[model samples]
Target chain A: MSLGEFDLIARHFTRPARRSPLGVGDDCALIAPAPGMQLAVSSDMLVEGRHFLSTVAPERLGHKALAVNLSDLAACGAKPLAYTLALALPRADDTFLAGLARGLHALADRHDLDLVGGDTTAGPLNLCLTIFGEVPTGAALLRSGARPGDELWVSHPLGEDEPGWLGDARLALEVFRGTPGLRVPGEAFDHLRLAMECPEPRVALGLALRGVASSAIDVSDGLLGDLQHVLRRSGPDGRPLGVVLDADALPRSPLMRAQTAALQHECLLAGGDDYELLFTAAPADHGAVRAAGQRSATGVRCIGRITAESGTTVHDRHGHRVATPWASFDHFRS
Target chain B: MSLGEFDLIARHFTRPARRSPLGVGDDCALIAPAPGMQLAVSSDMLVEGRHFLSTVAPERLGHKALAVNLSDLAACGAKPLAYTLALALPRADDTFLAGLARGLHALADRHDLDLVGGDTTAGPLNLCLTIFGEVPTGAALLRSGARPGDELWVSHPLGEDEPGWLGDARLALEVFRGTPGLRVPGEAFDHLRLAMECPEPRVALGLALRGVASSAIDVSDGLLGDLQHVLRRSGPDGRPLGVVLDADALPRSPLMRAQTAALQHECLLAGGDDYELLFTAAPADHGAVRAAGQRSATGVRCIGRITAESGTTVHDRHGHRVATPWASFDHFRS
Candidate 1:
């Protein structure tokens, strides 16, 4: 059924806010951070074709929209609280709205996040979600806290895999684009599609790493590119820090390893939309890191160490310097 | 000059946040409410063609974008704090970015609002801003608090006017659309354009009315339509509250009064984007309300009163019921 803007919001977006004093109906949503807690806010906008394929299911699009924003919170080690979604649609279709709401609310319920307030209008399809979370004062993870001696860690394996295994979202995009001579097994195809459309933000792992990890960031715009942000931000005084990422030490699934060396390198280093936490901690906290990983039920792998140098360098299994060429996804660039 | 996505953000949107612990270039921006305060949050999205004409200046577009979001905060009697802006641009034009940033920052600086965090991407031109403000615990004005016998008020006079006088934004829209037989004086055209593009949010007025006003809302939607929101929400038990708005008391300018009766009715009653505070207060608080208006340097006019009835009705100067044929602007319906 066709619905007016207000009816659409009342039917699909409005929910009783448990943590907020008010939600959905008012001009502004009221929220107060718990005593001694700070609110962590992040915003992300996704446009059709630019961020997701039009062929992607509306349910998965909803999931990914919130997933990407939650990933930002996960990077900061903040607990999900509430979010405002501003959506622009070409037309308000009943089936699309239902599936989108179902997917959005499902993930929100899992994290106890309330859909607090937002704006809806008719325009080109765009989804902008601004999320709010909370963390104890002075305890939030930041990109600039990693020191020179900290060891780099990733929360998950970083490549294509079988149906039940974690893989890269870029694989799905490549398949959708019909990349030349790229034939994937049916099971692997399913795994890659899941990776692209339904990434799981590592919120639990982020929380677990709060005290143990020196600093953290989520892997979105490729590992190397995002890692550069942390490295650049964490620079000490005038001397910038660097990393010695061992190419072989970068975790990859067996299916990914079976691919050509170039494809493997591209997927492992430059694949975007992983939503895994890449973090750093001192060598002394190795046991604590492992314990935290176990507590959160997430895998942790050390691939490098923060160094006193000023640029990132990758070394292969044979201790040979690798030629790195793939750059991370930039919205304005091809 | 060509800019990548990150460069565009760093150049145009990045600023040192005054109140926030963290700002742009982080996974999340951190903010905390002061003791005994609650955070008020609101979001608004603007799209090209639908929200504004392509001929509108980019600077004014930026101002209007943030103005609408701040109007939400004002309606809730919240003090502005900071905001996140998520923008989708068709291209990274240096001139456009500079103008947009200038206009955005000008309003932000005037309000003492920090540019906390946001997202930017390449897509159809769209702007979404999520703003944060603070109010004393339990003192926020709500749409549901207007009681029967309270007087309905508006912050400013409605309808169009000549140059140097307040006017309705809809007049500018009508002029842009080239409506038949509509001739606006050149000087009046300038004022109407300003009314449409650079709406000033009544933040000071809202702050002054915190304790005096029972309920408040901004006139983004038409007066009659938005009043219905307050009336419906303020229902006592199962019965809804209503308003007896005097059409003649709507406070039209001389230019507006010269218009045809039908045109006057449309502009004063159903024109959107006025961004004026429409509020209610008890008859006992009349003196206090006047003091608030004086304190904030805003015009406050009483145009109607709340009643125990179930729906709104309009009365002309002769005390005869008038047919209200105009509906407010609904995004999906029209």
Candidate 2:
């Protein structure tokens, strides 16, 4: 049977909120942050075709829609608390909503994040989630604290570090797009697809890095694009500093390592949607950073350092600069 | 110059948040509710062609998007605090965004509701807003507390009580669609248009009704449909109470009164987008309701009473039941 808006909400979204004072009814949901804690809130919208292909499954879409927003909280070193989802649908299909709700709830339950409230309406397919988290007052990791000599790190290795896990969702996209001269062995495709379809947000690592990381941002747009936001805002009164990225240090799967330099450079630097935590820490906190990575259960890789110079540079192992112009995803160029 | 997502945010949305610990630019915004206060949260989504018409002004769309969400907070008697906007655009156009941002900011500033944090992306046109508010513990008005002797009230009279302020946005839609035999005189068309475009959320009255109202709701869907939600959920252990709505008691504008009974019934009973506050209070609290209306600078009309019987019914002056079946707007029926 088809579901109307209210019925769909009741069936799919009306769940008990463990943390909130009230959930999923009346005019507004009620919540109270623990005293001395600040509410960390962020919102993200995912549109079909633009953010995901229609061919992608709905459950994965649900996971990803929330994942991207949670990634923001992760970038800020906040503990997941609660969220509100506002979804626009073209029609009320029960099966689609079931899968979508299941996918959303699984991740939310894993993090102990309560689904406090949201609205569902009829329109084109769109999912927007606003996640709420908590951090101690004045202790949140920000994009404005990076300084010269700060060590840049990523929560997870960008490429395949182990046989079972290959973080090549970007490459998988290229392959799906029929890019020539690309090959992946069996089951590796599944891993890559999963990485692309459902990104695991680095919330634990973020919580661990609360006091260790100086500045941070999620890699949603290309690494360079998001990193530039840190670089732009961290400047002393709008004066930007350069960053040096170690080409050899960039985590790449063995397969990616064998690709031509141009393709490898493209995937390694500008490939967006990795959803990894790219953060910076003082050089003195390297040990603490490593410990944070240990607790987070993710590899923390130091791929570069902040510099006092202008513009971003990629250096070879020999320390010679590679001449790859900066390229990051832009939502609108047309 | 066209604004990139960041540039657009910087130029338009980058305002200092007086109430929040942090505002736009961070991965997440940090808000600390006052001591003894609980956070009230709601989310709403407006897709192009669904919530609005394409020819509608961008500014109006911006205002309405946030207004509708704020109305939810008002319904719960929560004080508006902050909101996050997630916008998807086909391309980066400055004029459209400028008007949109102006409209959004104007309303945000009026309520001292900070624009906390949001995400802007490239996609089809879609806007989602998640609003945050605050209410003292145990003081929020809900939809389940009305008693059999309580009187039903609306913050504003529906029909023309005063010249130049007929809220007929839904009717304006009919006018815009060139519905035959409907003529709105002079600038009444513009007035109706504004009523539709810029809804006044009854936050003041909502705050005033915090302790006075037994139960409350915002009139978004037609009066009867939304009221049924109250009546259905307000019942003891979810048992419903019947409502006797005096048809003559419904507030109607002079123009609406001139329409045929069917059309008047359609607009008065089931017309959507009025955004007025509908509440029930103890019979003795009628004076308190009037005072709240006075403080809110809006009219308060008592149109009905709660009864021991089940289900809602429209009655004529002689106490004869009117057979107009309950109807309201539904997004999807197919």
Candidate 3:
């Protein structure tokens, strides 16, 4: 059925949390941070063809748009408060927009974030989700605080599912689409589908590491590339960090281990869109981090340590130099 | 020459901003407000065909995108501080991006705002500008405070250049191409061009009216239509407001008067994108408002007054009912 903008908003965006004192349907949303908190704001843009494949589902696209930005706030140890979504969609199709908004609303509700003010207009699919979070002043983490002697840790092992790991193409498709090619249960397939389509923002893990972590950033442009950014942005007092990934320390699901195995390390190092936290902290905080990880049930791995030299080096299990990290998806690539 | 997104960002988006604590290269911008001030944040989106013609000057489109969002902060009586622009363009042409950046930079410099952080992605042309401003808590004006018996005022002449309005195909083409048809002296054309391309943000006027105005909103949609929003958002204890427009009391320019003879009165009531403040104040503040207007050298006229009524009514010069207002340009209209 045809849908107008307001109808889509009503159907998919109507939520009780939106009754926030400063919520959707206003010229500008009014916000008041709790006393002693500083507001952290971040914006991200997802463009059709560039940021996502056209074959991807619209709901997944919406979820990823907000997920990435929320991940940014999570990196700063901030709690998500509200977000403004500027959507430029190609057509006024009810089915497509509703699915997209449903994904966004579900994510917002999961995080307890109120959808605030934003704008919608006609264009090729482009979503800019601007999110605001609140962190106590002087406590928000930054990428500039990595100390020369600090240990560099990743929230989870990098490269979970390599291209070569997922079994035969047809079998994998059957598993992904909930059909029983190998007799995988429907509930298991559903769980896998949820894992592939929607990712929970690492809010609890981020907040838990707040005072202990010295520097942090979410791994969006793959582990190696994003670590390069953290290294590059380290302040004058901080030092460049070399991340040494123990090939055997990498984490993986049973399904991820079953597929093709050639060049699996290279693929995991180069592939992007893994929104895990990569952070640096003092050696003393390691005990606290390990204890907290036990309580939270979230993965925490120490991959390397900060260095005085200004470069990134990823060593193999045998401690040999590996291929340099390639650039992640660049929209203006020729 | 083809450009990669990283190079585009380094070349065009990495300019040092005097006001930003941490600038464009960071994950999130850090801006500390002047002590004790609350931040005002607003966002607006401009789609290629919806907001302007594709042939419209890229520079003007950039300026208008940021200017329109700044107007929202002005409506709330906040001082412009910084902005993040998320642009989705079809291609990464250096010339187009540079011109757009220059237009945005020029206006931002005039207002002393920093172009902080944003995302750039490839898609159909769409520009989303999210701006931030600061006002002391409890001092920011809102759209919900209008009361019965308050006087309605607007910041500029009721009718802008009707014939030369941006939508007129001939005028828009001439302005874009720098053709001399319907030309005035260079300085006058500069003013006209500024009006057409980058209208100034009314931050100062908005700030001055902080305590005086009961309610305010920037006139982006036509005057009557936007005013209806202010009325509809009236707070629970606020008296019902009735606005009566005295066609004679509207602020007018010499050119506007000459053009009014040909362009009907409806143009005055319905023409959009004035980017001027339309606000209400208690009748007791009228004299003070007149004095404030005189000192600032800007138009602030008493166009109407609020009354204890449920709906609004407009009058002709001879007190006849005006036809109902039409909807502003709908982006989804085919």
Best by TM-score: 1
Ranking by DockQ: 1, 2, 3
TM-scores of the models, in the given order? 0.95, 0.94, 0.84
Looking at candidate 3, what TM-score does chain B attain?
Answer: 0.83
Per-residue C-alpha lDDT of model 3 across residues A100-141, encoded as one tens digit per residue: 887787788888888877877777777888888878878888
How do the residues B1-334 of candidate 1 rate in per-residue lDDT, one tens digit apiece?
1336468667888888998888887899999889999999999999999888788788898899999999999999999999999999988887888889999999999999999988888899999999999999999999989999999999873233322122357767777878876657767777667878889898999999999999999988778777878887888764668789888888666666666767777877888788889999999999999999999877888999999876777888899987767653233221
A1-334, model 2: which lDDT tens digit per residue?
A: 1335567767877887898888877778888889888889999998888788888888898889889888899999999999998888888888898889999999999999999887778777889999999899888999889999999997665335442122366787887798887766656676667767888888999999998999999887767777888887788867777799997787777767767777777777777788889999999999999999888788888999999876788888999887666564233221
TM-score of chain B of each: 0.93, 0.92, 0.83
lDDT per residue for candidate 1 within A224-293, as digits (tens), equals 8788888878887645588899888877666666667777677778887888899999999989999988
Q: In terms of TM-score, which candidate is stronger, 1 or 2?
A: 1
DockQ of each: 0.62, 0.59, 0.39
Writing each residue's lDDT as its tens digit, candidate 2 over B262-313 gives: 6677777777788888899999999999988888777888989998677677
DockQ of model 3 vs. true complex: 0.39
Q: After superposition, how far is residue A217 of candidate 2 from its true place, in Å?
A: 0.9
Candidate 3 lDDT over B1-334, as tens digits, reads 1236568756876678787555565556666666677677788888877777786677787778888988899898888888888877777888888888888887888789888788877778788888888888778788888887889998863246422232222233344667543333444444455555556557778877878888898877567767776776673444334567765565544434444332434445655667778899998999877766666555687888777775667666688766544533222111
Ranked by lDDT, the better of candidates 2 and 3 is 2
* Interface RMSD (Å) of candidate 2: 4.7
Off by over 4 Å in 1: A1-5, A157-167, A328-334, B1-3, B157-167, B328-334
lDDT of 3 at B35: 62
* Candidate 1: residue B325 Cα off by (Å): 1.4
